[model samples]
Target: MIHLRSLQRLTLAQRRRTATGLRAGTILLAAVAATLSRAPAARAAPEPVKVVVVANFENGADQGDAPGEFQFWVEREHLDHPVALRGAPDVLRRGRDGLYGMVLRHGVTDLAAFILDPRFDLRRTYWLFTGISGVDPRSASVGSAAWARWVVDGDELREIDDRTVPAGWPYGLWAIGADAPNRLPSDPNHFGSVTELSQLSKAFPLNAGLARWAFDLTKDVPISDDDAIRRARAAWNGFPAAQRPPFVLMGETLGSRRYWHGEPRTRWAEDWVRLWTGGRGVFVMTNMESQTNQEVMRTFGRQGLVDPDRIMVLRTASNFSEPPPGVPVTASIGDEGPGQRLAFDSNERVGAPVVRELLAHWTRYRDAIPGRP
Candidate 1:
């Protein structure tokens, strides 16, 4: 009977220990689950984009074809991933280096469509607008590149036929509210007054410091100069700036839907840019899309869709805005001359470094723009 009681006591003790062990395990598991439940959830990674290269057009296949504004970039950058937007002619491409390139149509419509699409986010994006344009002979020679400090609109103006313009008027084109050419329109504050743009403004100033930075970064980079280029530049004898070899500079751009040529029109562009910018801007390049593009970007900026301060415009000189000495306006207007190829080469040479710099130290430039305090 004593042995039986001892065994029974031992069994009871064993049972108690077993029950306590199980309860402790259960409590430990419950504590672990509670802690996990209180912890924050893992967040999705942000969409990575270092730089977005906005090119105007492409000539052929993105690779293994004759180069265009977009082709060299696509090929050189190894932009292999293609994302096709439905109902769009060009495909958006991305590289593993966090670079995105898109060949936007020549005007505002396509850019607006791309920006409005829900497929991508661009609020943190940096835009580099680049293309070939008619270079003002007084500013820079063909094959030269200009970082625009201001983009002036040449289309929103009043014009009469140059032949029928009143005597002493340089050209028929003038500000919408102005009574005469070369005159700034009255301020909108004036009673019953039509002003420079009425309710709209003509000049869109880009980041001046940024332009200077880009110009400084690329100004020393060698531009393409060949026998063809030398021969083409030789014709600009009277214009000292145009006779020089290609280079990089800071200048302003004038954009219009209509393509106009001739010495008189060139003078008009120069004066128009100066008037709109309150004499702070100098016209250097001419194109068909910049004003419209800047307008769309400004609207997007107002809506919080983009940061306008991050935008940069780089235009290389594909041709002269007006004829060389003794060349007919019609002949010179149609010919891009040898500078076309030189411009293409110069654009890539000058733009690639800026892109690379942004990419190399993305941690710094991702939030802070270069040349800004």
Candidate 2:
């Protein structure tokens, strides 16, 4: 028989081993539980959304965050895996495969809020700014669409009343560092006089390759026509492109905050863009948001959040910037008729195909950004 002390020692040793094994098993289980809990968060992060459409309002109606003039792009395109974006002034709607859209109120402030929102991962995103704008009757008709090469800010200028303007000046408005209206300094680098706009808001030019690529994709796609649009085009008799049915053409934009209208203002827009672009651009679309959009992009671009070069602005004509040949400005402003609808429809008409092409060939462009001339 064994001694009691030795037996007790043997039993103590067995109990110690059992306790150690149990502790190890418990620790392993705890580690597994911790890992399992973290899986949900990893799954929750959404995939990156590409191809964002920037729109301001509903074509006719707001269909519960979608099917608006901007939202329609989501449904018609059948975008998938949509997730509502957070950390914005308002939640922006985003889709997984390709389409994403945001509705901005009519100003720089509203657009700035949305662009500065932290939740969006705009890196590698291709921003498509689609909106309805007043058309320059000289450049396009009521339903003509122009792909902008230069987005010129129309608000920044020195102005005198037209009645007291200097002789030979086209209008009251004059760009800084210039002798008179329509006169821009020959040297872009050195202006003899220091001007307010020299450092403030001025102009942004889109990537020529991308703008041209877009035009090539949609140039031949026939624009939808209707009675109202046809009647509007009839008034643009002298302008060959405008007289033809609604079509896509490459042009430029003038963005202003004042909403100034009339024949004189339109002439100013043309000259302003010409001066800013060194007479290389023709003003076709008059809009309110292009300058605002670029300002936001410039910030994001430095942070590597968005590629400013990839951003493209596409404007469709909703009304004439000035009255058609004989129509009075006051009467024309209120009577846009069906061209409003056509403008919305035409944006999608040209925009949709280019979007489709990108989606269809995702493999080629997934890692590489397109638009090389």
Candidate 3:
């Protein structure tokens, strides 16, 4: 009988040779097919056409409005053309994880073409991201829409050296705006890169109306009474002067245990918003959970994926600080849910105008952007 060891060696060698021969033959066949197929060389894959929508649980106080508004604008209006709107897989929520899976499912890589192929769009299509974010109470008011010069996955995080310095030590990955005029000037040790959308912004500044509409919708909403806003500011004030982070970072999706403090996972679902809408803009709104303001902006400043000039972050103040001693604090902000009208009726009225504005912006910006379909 043949020795077992010798037999094994012979089998392995034969497998390797067969594999090599198969590869060679495959290449030969491909060459022949290419010649026979057509006179012109095969064209590169079409450029990826995508957009992103964020359903923040912040400002609107109800998650319902965010998703509902996105569906109406993206599916009903913008996507009325021949393009397709791909649905992302449902996120897995369990254990200590909250929105962690949601973020990975929606991060830059999980986006349409990125999920399919980083170079999915070589020539056609576009990607867009829409959603809500919190604005600095000092700088922005409730319902006002603002665009990001850069969008930092405020929640998605990595480790950093737990050391303090005069200049500030940097550690972590931040996606900056592709079209941002200047790179973030903070820490030099952090990981930063301009995103694909940022490049598109340079060619086209994105529809200005989307930002305008967000402003219109929330412009009148009272921010003085919201509890979240009151508490967030208080939290900021509570921080020691030396420990306070420079910029305010706010997003509903960031506070969840899943992303801000979780393991490596796919943020694919969130990426769907990008695939459906050609990259146009990024929206920052509010959510139920309160998060560290400095942390939020630091994340954005680090990434540089969004254009800071175009960034719109809108926040409705839920609560204002009470006056001390004999002073009385009046309720300056409006209620969270549907204001005066019935919930359904109010949503339709308030949301319709916003949608219309978005469509108008899309038409103007889409046509203006270079390399856009």
Highest TM-score among the candidates is held by which one? 1
Model 3 scores a C-alpha lDDT of 0.28
C-alpha RMSD by candidate, in order = 20.5, 17.7, 16.7
List pairs with backbone clashes in candidate 2. 59-69
Model 2 CA deviation exceeding 4 Å by range: 1-46, 59-61, 64-68, 79-82, 87-91, 105-120, 185-201
Identify the candidate with maximal lDDT.
Answer: 1
Q: Flag the better candidate by TM-score, 2 or 3.
A: 2
Model 2 per-residue lDDT tens digits across residues 286-308: 87767666665665465565687
Clashes (backbone N, CA, C under 3 Å), per candidate, total 0, 1, 95
Local accuracy of candidate 3 as per-residue lDDT tens digits, 1-373: 2221232234333322221011211110001000011213555654332222232222231223554323333233333222221233332111110101112233321222122222233122222233333222333333333332223223323333334322432323322321111222233333344333332221112334444544445445322223432333343333232122222222222222232211111122122112222333232323322232222222233333222232233232221112212322233222333211122222223333443443445555333442223
Report the Cα lDDT for candidate 2. Answer: 0.66
Global CA lDDT computed for model 1: 0.75
Candidate 1: the clashing residue pairs are none
> Candidates' TM-scores?
0.83, 0.78, 0.32
- Distance from true location, Cα of 266 in model 2, Å: 1.6
Q: Could you give the candidate ranking by lDDT, starting with the highest?
A: 1, 2, 3
**Rank list by TM-score:** 1, 2, 3
